[model samples]
Target chain A: MYLAKIFVTHKKSILDPQGEAIKNALHRLDYEAVENVSQGKYFETTLNCDSEDKAKQITDSICDSLLANPNMETYRFEIEKVGD
Target chain B: MKFAVISFPGSNCDYDMYYAIKDILKEPVEMVSCDTESLDGFDAVLIPGGFSYGDYLRSGAIAKFAKVMPALIKFANLGKPVLGVCNGFQILTEVGLLPGSLQNNRDMQFISEYEPLIVQNNKTIFTNEYEKAESIMIPIAHGEGNYYCNETELESLKQNHQIIFTYENNPNGSVSNIAGITNKNGNVMGMMPHPERAVEKILGSEDGVRLFTSILKSFKGGILVE
Candidate 1:
C-alpha cells in the first residue's frame, strides 16, 4: 500500500479572511513575532496501489479534480510506501 | 416561454425561483432535479441559490459534478439564457461556465441584506430591461460572495462588456465591485445576489422583476408587452 499526504492552501494572490482573523487573534494575544498566518487543509489517504508512483498520480488527480479549486487554491502532495 | 429551475440537493431557493417565474413573471416554469441529465423544452434555465451538497470541500465544488451540469453546459452553448444566483453562481464558476471564484466576505461574516446594484451593461438579454448605469436594489444573502479573478480575466471581462452588475457601495469586497457577470456570449449569467427574493414588493424590492422580464422579452424576439 501507499500513503498520500496532501496540503491545500489559498493562492498567494487571493485574500484569506479566516487566516487574517486568526492572525489578528494571535496579535491580540501578544504573539508579536508572528507577522502572518495563512490557513489551509491537510488530507492523509492510504491507497491500494502497490507502487508509490501510481499512488502519487492518483492523489494528484484527486487534488486537481476535487480537493482543490484551482481558481482560488493550490495543492501539493507527498507519497510514501506503506506496508501491505 | 418555459423556464426550468434546477433543484440541486440542498437547494433552498429553488421554489422561490419557480414562484418568481410562474406567478410573478407569468410564465411557465418547472422544477428540474440536478440528478437529471436532460434539459430539453426549456427556454431558459435558472440555477437557484443554496448550500448544494452541503457545500462540502468548497462551495459549488461537488454540485458542479452533478448529472445535470453537462446538460446545462450544452444548453448554455446553444445560446440559451442561463441564470445562476448565489450558490448557483459559485457552481457556474466551479464548472467553468463562468469565470472567477467566490471567497468568504472580507469581514468574514454571513451577510443577508438588501443592497443597491448598478447596471453596467444593459445590452444583454439578462439586463436589457434596465438602463445603462441604472441603480437597482436587490437582496444578497451569502457568506462567500466576494468574487475574485486574475487580472487578465478581469481585463477580458471588462473588454467584452461581460460585467453586467456592480454593487453600488461594494458590499462584499468583490473585485471591481462586481456583483454579477455574464459569459462572453452574454447568454449565461452568474450573480451573487438573489433576484428571486426581491421579485415581490412585499418581500422587499420589486426591481428584480426586470431581469426576468428581460429574458422573456428576448425570447419573444425583443417585443415586451409590459
Candidate 2:
C-alpha cells in the first residue's frame, strides 16, 4: 500500500490575494517579522497499489486533470510505502 | 433565438438568466442540467452565476468535468454564442474556453453592488447594441471576481480586440481593468458582472438589456425588419 500527499498552490507569477490578506493580518497581530506567506491546498489519500511507480502515476494524473488549474496553479506530490 | 441556461449543482442564478431571455427578451430559453449530454436545438448557451459544485476545490475547478461540458465545447466550436457570467465565467476559464482565471479580490472581500463597465468592443454579437467605449452600470456579486491572465495572453487579447468590457473604477483589481472578454473568434464570452440581474429598471439598471438585444439582433442578421 502507498500513501500519497498532494499540495496545490498558485503559480509564482500569480497574485495570491488570500495569502496576501493573511500576511497583512499577521502583521496586524504583531507578527511583522514574517516576510511572506503562501497558501495552498493539501490532499492525502491511500493508494491501493503495491508499486511506487503506479502510485506516482495515479497521483500525478489526478493532479494534472483536476487537482490544479495549470493556467494559474502548480502542484507537487509525494508517495510513501504504508503497509503491505 | 433559443437559448440554453446550464444549471449546475449549486447554480442559483439559472432562473435569473432564464427570465432575462424568456420573459424580458421574449425569446425561447430552457434550463439545462449539468448532467445533460447534449445541447442540441439551442442557438445559444448561458452559464449563470453561483458557486457551482459548492466551489469545493475552487470556484470552477470541479465543474469542467460536468457531463454537459463536451456538448458545450461542440456548441462553441460551431461558432454559437456562449455567455458565462460570474461563476459561469470561472467555469469557462476552467474549461479553457476562455483565457485567464478569476481569483480572490485584491481586498479579499465579497463585493456585491452596481459597478460601472465600459463596452470595449461593440462589433461582437454580445455587445453590438452598445457604442464603443460606452459605460453602463451592472451588478457584480462575487468573492472571486478578480481576473488574471499572463502577459503574453494579455498582449494577444489587446491586439485582437478580444477584450469586450473593462471596469470604470476597477472594483476587483482585475488585470487591465478587465471585466469581460471573448475568445479570439468572438463567439464565446465570459464576464464577471451579472447582466441578467440588471435587465430591468425595477432591478436597478436596464443597461444590460441591450446586451441581450445585441445577441438576438445578431441572430436576425444584425437588424430587425419588423
Candidate 3:
C-alpha cells in the first residue's frame, strides 16, 4: 500500500484572503520578516496499488477529477510506501 | 414555461427558487434530484443557492460530479435557458458550463444583504424585461462570491456582451465588478445574486420578478404581449 500526501493551493495570480488574514495576525505578533502567506488544502490517502508508478497515476487522476479544481487551484503530491 | 429546480445535497435555497416560480410566477416547476440521469421535460433549469456537499474541497466542487450534472450539461448544451444563482453560479463554473471561478469574498466575510446591480446587457433572453443600463436591487448572500477570470477571457466577455450584470458597488473584489455573466452563447447564466429571493415585495424587493418574466417571454417568443 502507498500513501499519497497532496497539497493544493490557490494559484499565485489568485488572491488568498485567508492567507492575508493569517499574515496580518502574524504581523501583530511582530513577525516582521514574513513577507507573504498563501493558503491551501492538504489530503492524505492510502491507495492499494501494484507499484509506485501505479500509485502516482491514481494520485494524478484523483487530483485532476476531484481534489484540485483546475480553474484556480494547483496541486502536488508525494507518495510513500506505508504498508505491506 | 416548465422549470426544474435542481436539488443537490445541502441545497438550502431550492425551496425559495421553487416558491419563486410556483407561488409567485404561477408557473409549473418541480424539484429534480441530483442523482437523476436526465432532464427530459424541463424547459428551464435552476440551480439555486446554498452550500452543496457542505462546500467540501471548494464550493460546488463535489456537486459537479453529481449524477444529474451530466444531464445539466446536456441541457445547457442544448441552448436552453439555465440560471444559477449564488452557489449555483459556483457549480456552473465548476461544471464548465460557464467561464471563470468564484473565490472567497475580498473581505472574507459572508455578506447577506440587498445590493444594487446594473443591467449591463438586456438583449439576452434572461434580461429582456429590464431596460439597458437599468439599476436594480437584489439580495446577495455568500462568502465566496468574488468572481475571477483571465484578462483574455474578460476581454472576450466584454466583446461578446456576456456580462449580464455588474455590481453598482463592488462588494466581493470581483474582476470588473462582475456580478453575473452569461456563457458565450448567452443561454447559460450564472450570477451571485439571489433573484428568486427578491422575487416578491413581501420578501423584500420585487426587482427579481422581471428576471423570471423575461424567461417566460423567451419561451413565448418574446412577444411581450403580457
Candidate 4:
C-alpha cells in the first residue's frame, strides 16, 4: 500500500486573496513585519496495489490526473509494507 | 438563438441559466452534461456557476478535464460565444481558454450577495447591451473568485480592451478589481458574478436579461435566428 499526500496552491505569481486577508489581520493584531501569506489544500490517500512499484504508479496517476493541478500544485508519495 | 449550458457534477446554477435562456430570453437552451463529447450545432455555449466537481483539488481544476471541455475549447476556437460564470470562470482560466487564476476568497468563506459591476468593454458581444462604464448589480456566490494575472498580461489585456467588467466597490481582492474579462477574439467571456441568477425580476433584478438579448441580437444580425 502507498500513502499519497497532495498539496494544491495558486502559482507563486498568482495573488492569494486569503493570504492577504490573513496578513492584514495579523497586522491588526500588532504583529510586526509579517510579509506575506499563501494558502493551499492538503489531501491524503491510501492506495491499494499489489507491489510497491504498482502502488507508486497508481498514486502518481491519481494525483496528477485528479488530485492536483499541475500548473498550480505539486504532490508526493510514500510507501510502507503492510502486515510486515 | 440556440444555446447550451454545460452542467458539471456539483454545478448548482445550471437551472438558473436554463430559466434565463428559456423563460426570460425565450431562447432555446439545452442543458449539456459535462460528460458529453461534442458541442455540434450549438451557436453558443455557456458554462454556468456552482461548485463544479465539488471545487475539488482546486476550484475548477478537476472540471477542466471533463469530457465536455474539449467541445468548449472547440467552440471557443471557432469564435462562438462562450461564457464562464463564477466556478465556470475558474474552469476557463484553468483550461487556458482565458488568462488569470482564481484564488481563495479573502474571507476564506463562501460569499453570496449582490455586488456592483462596472461594464468596461461594451464592444464585446457579451456586454454590448450595456454602455461602457455602466454599473449593474449582479449576484456573486463563490469561495474562490479573486482574479490574478501577471503584470505584462494585465497590461496587454488593458491595451486590448479584453477587460469587460470591474468591481464597483472591490468586494474581492481581485487584481485591478477586475470582475470579468473576454478573450482576445472577444468570443469567450468569464465573469465571477452570476448574471443568470439576476435575469428575472423575481430574483430582484433583470439586469442579466440584457446579456442574453445582446448575444441573440449579435447572432441575428444578417443571419437566420437559430
Per DockQ, the best of the predicted structures is: 2
lDDT (tens digit, per residue) of candidate 1 on B50-135: 99999988999999899998999999998899999999999999999999899999989899999999999999998888999999
Candidate 2: residue pairs that collide: none
- Once fitted onto the true fold, the runs of candidate 1 whose alpha carbons sit more than 4 angstroms away are B222-226
Candidate 4: residue pairs that collide: none
Tens-digit lDDT string for candidate 2 (B112-153): 999999999998989988999999999999999999999999
Clashes (candidate 3)? 0
Runs of candidate 4 with Cα error greater than 4 angstroms are A1-38, A43-84, B222-226
DockQ of each: 0.84, 0.85, 0.77, 0.36
Candidate 2: chain B TM-score equals 0.97
Candidate 1, DockQ to 2 decimals?
A: 0.84
Ranked by DockQ, the better of candidates 1 and 3 is: 1
Q: Whole-model lDDT, candidate 3? A: 0.93
Counted clashes in each candidate structure: 0, 0, 0, 0
Per-residue alpha-carbon lDDT of candidate 1 for residues A21-50, written as tens digits (9 for 90 to 100):
899999999999998899999999999987
Considering DockQ, where higher is better, how would the candidates rank from best to worst? 2, 1, 3, 4
lDDT of 2: 0.93
Stretches of candidate 3 off by over 4 Å are B222-226
